[model samples]
Target: MESEKYNADLSRFHGMIENLPCGFFIAQAQKPYRLLYANDEMLRLFDCRDLRDFCRYIEQDVRNIVAVNDRERVEREIGHDLQAKSDRFEHVRSHLFTRESRIRYADISGRLVGTEEFGPVFYCTLQEIDIPQPGQMVDRDIRDYVVGHLDEAIANQWIQVYYQPVIRTLTGELCGMEALARWVDPHVGFLSPAAFIPVLEQVRLIYRLDSFVLEEACRIMRQRMDEGLPITPVSVNLSRYDFDLMDVCQVLEQTRQKYSLPRDFLHVEITESALAQDSAVMHQTIDRLREEGYEVWLDDFGSGYSSLNILKDYNIDLIKLDMGFLRTFTDASRSIVTAVITMAKELGIKTLAEGVETKEHADFLASIGCGRQQGYFYGKPQPIGGTLAHIESEGRGIEPRKWCHYYDVASMFIRQTDRACALFDRYGDGHVHCLYANKTYGEQVHELGYQLQDIEEDLGRPETAEVVRTFWAYVDRSRKSGQMETYFYIDGGDYVNTALQVVCEMNQHLLIYVEIQNLSQSNAGRRQSKLDENLRYLYTMFEDVYLVHI
Candidate 1:
């Protein structure tokens, strides 16, 4: 369907061609496609009016622009079909002066139009597309847009708060709720924190966002109470980035005052990996939140080893499991379930199993004397309809789950294949990685090995078939070349960078493995503070191992 064509004053385009600094041309596809017309600027720019001129003047061909050895093959593709083509069209060959004319990348667009005189004219336009100019924001409108802040009224209207209930398995009571936030941008629809929090953090706007979430949550909770719903306590998870500018305690206090919220009615859930992250920062923050009457729960207890110790070290209120455990909830998950729950019990820390999906999973967990559970089994995460409503009946919460895996396997070392070095180890050439590590390392003794690709993917994973073949290679390197230094992951399934020296031990090598955590990647770098932190970094050396299979 052809649309009506509109015509403008011919002089408008003619004036543009004459004054433009770059050259412009009109060529025919007929032999040599003799230049139909060339402006004075074209002659002045190329230093020659002659279309045949080369050397200093480079003739740009549509075909040559796209590099291909077969010029005839390319010429065959001149019309509408370029299905056989793959690469982008670049300036196949340009003169020294052609490159000098453009600052950054030259922007180009091409269009084919049939003209009354020329029949078919491929119009190509070039414009300079460099980096934003130094004074790009000098314009008043742009300047105002950069420093502007969202007004309170507009912000409050678009911001929404949701909550996920924290359940007490013993009574099947909604112990508390964790506040979640959703932002609706007038222009962008709904926005997730993953999309905006980093921007806010970069601009130091996270504190304000956190405050918004907390205040809104409290307001919602208060309304729920008035509606005869009893969801009193709520937890709010915060990012380490938010705490960088000011203490979270002070911020929370301000929020409490601003919202007139109860002290004990609100709790802060800190991830276990986060606590195991920066002890000093975590201790200071938790202490202050506690001092301010906010209960602190350690989220995701079994994520890291050092995190487990936090229950004993820090004044934490609750322990939550990482969701990864849910994937292991098959009958095979029996041992791991019992071991983790037992440890949490001994520590006097309340452990909440997360991501419960099925009734059998809930049953097996209950059977193990596990009282608390949270997951899809109870209900899905949803907007608070006043208060948290859970499936509850007067029943015993803690019972043994129909757990299939024996508890001894997941929690303790069992020598099945061969005698292994209970001591963890790492050995590899910098480029060709063949690491050896295990969860039971230092508790068991064995020589393990793996290659670079195998090791990188197997960071927190167990040994596999590919690992066996790679193990043999490491053995060859060690037996023929002698001792070497390398970094590897140990256990907990996550690799921790550690130094391991391969000792040609018909037995075991001394100090063959060294755990070296840069501390830069862990929670510390994020907290932006330095303190003595022990990651219990099992993955650092325990899990990721280099093994040589003979």
Candidate 2:
């Protein structure tokens, strides 16, 4: 009873630490700075997976996460604090890497805390300093400073463009990049976008900034091409105000023509929220742009007001799923994502999932069929010079992890099945969450990815809902009976003959396997001709959805 009580107390202690808002860490007061303990937020902030992973990484060196130049200074200061047994250390600006290996800046504070048993330890809290502090208003002086330097900065090359790479999910090939804006003020050092962009936008000077980025991005790509380097398409984001201020197409077309670049070389990305303004003009602009051989992507999708109506009406070439969409792993979120991918596939749209940090996120996305992705897993944004240097240097071998524990069954089957197949975990509801998918099914479903639970999405459409319902019912019954079931459904006039099998793994967990094949064109055509008659035949053919008892 005493031991049980102690264990319960310890569990509560862990819970409290995990719930802390700010990142907290405890490190030994010695060389190599061995990590003793860290809160969940600390792991999250440093982009460490867990305590075991974090300990494995440092191998007794705090410099593993610190910036190269800052390492010596950081170590010296910490050593001083430890030697003197300082009660507390004031805020110190520090550079660190997120679990995704993205570079970030933070204001760190450390306090020397210890007991006889531990000897000495440093407790630290990290507060990221790059973002604006809550309730801290932007000062007028900074605004005026920006306004005063705007013209000179433009002419003297203070504004810079950085390229963040986007890779093909399956092959890890460098497929494209996004052009981001940066400002380097000689007096103030590197000014973040959060600092200068609002000032620019307030003065309606954002167009000038966007134009510079577009031109410079094109020039950089052109230079790389001239150097005999293969260059992929680069996307430049345009503000809603940018579209209103100038002929966006004209600006892009002129830049392309001046560089003699191919039409597909440059891409445009517009935010989903921006779609609400001046719909008619925006529609016409997008239509004209597409006709002129340019691709327009919907940026930051599923962040705000993600209306299916916008997707249905717009002529968008691609949709970039926002990181927030996958921030929380839940059944509902998965279901929604599944539906979104399903609809996007039917509409012939491509998807690129952003903010993919972990191998789990990447594998899940690839299994769903969304193979175009970008995130810290690939690499962080770098200046044009850095990007070029990186390209010239050795390849960073950033590839999607081929296997995952959660989706082990699906991963195993994908390697062997030529036919499209998906592995699902029965959730004991009318729903089953897809765990893995074969490449054939994954790629065929959509260029981006689809969710397995998206089977529920078909229930909404009166056209395909009934057929899907029958299919699920068959699956559900067969799973319960510990057996196999076969069913069929029509996808875009193609008859997908499907077979479902259930297996009990060593863990005593049940896995449902879905195998699918697209019937030959002749067979599909013949089925299409007898669609009405076949609909009647489908119900009777199932014969009350009988299961083949294994």
Number of the top candidate by lDDT? 2
Q: How many backbone clashes does candidate 2 have?
A: 7
Q: Give a tens-digit lDDT track for model 1, residues 18-55.
A: 44454444444445443344444444433353434422
State which candidate has the highest TM-score: 2
Per-candidate TM-scores read: 0.42, 0.54
lDDT for every model?
0.47, 0.66
Relative to the true structure, candidate 2 reaches a TM of 0.54
Q: Each candidate's root-mean-square deviation in Å?
A: 23.3, 17.3
Candidate 2: which stretches are off by over 4 Å? 1-140, 388-419, 422-550
Off by over 4 Å in 1: 1-156, 226-229, 257-260, 279-281, 330-332, 386-550
lDDT of 2 at 166: 82
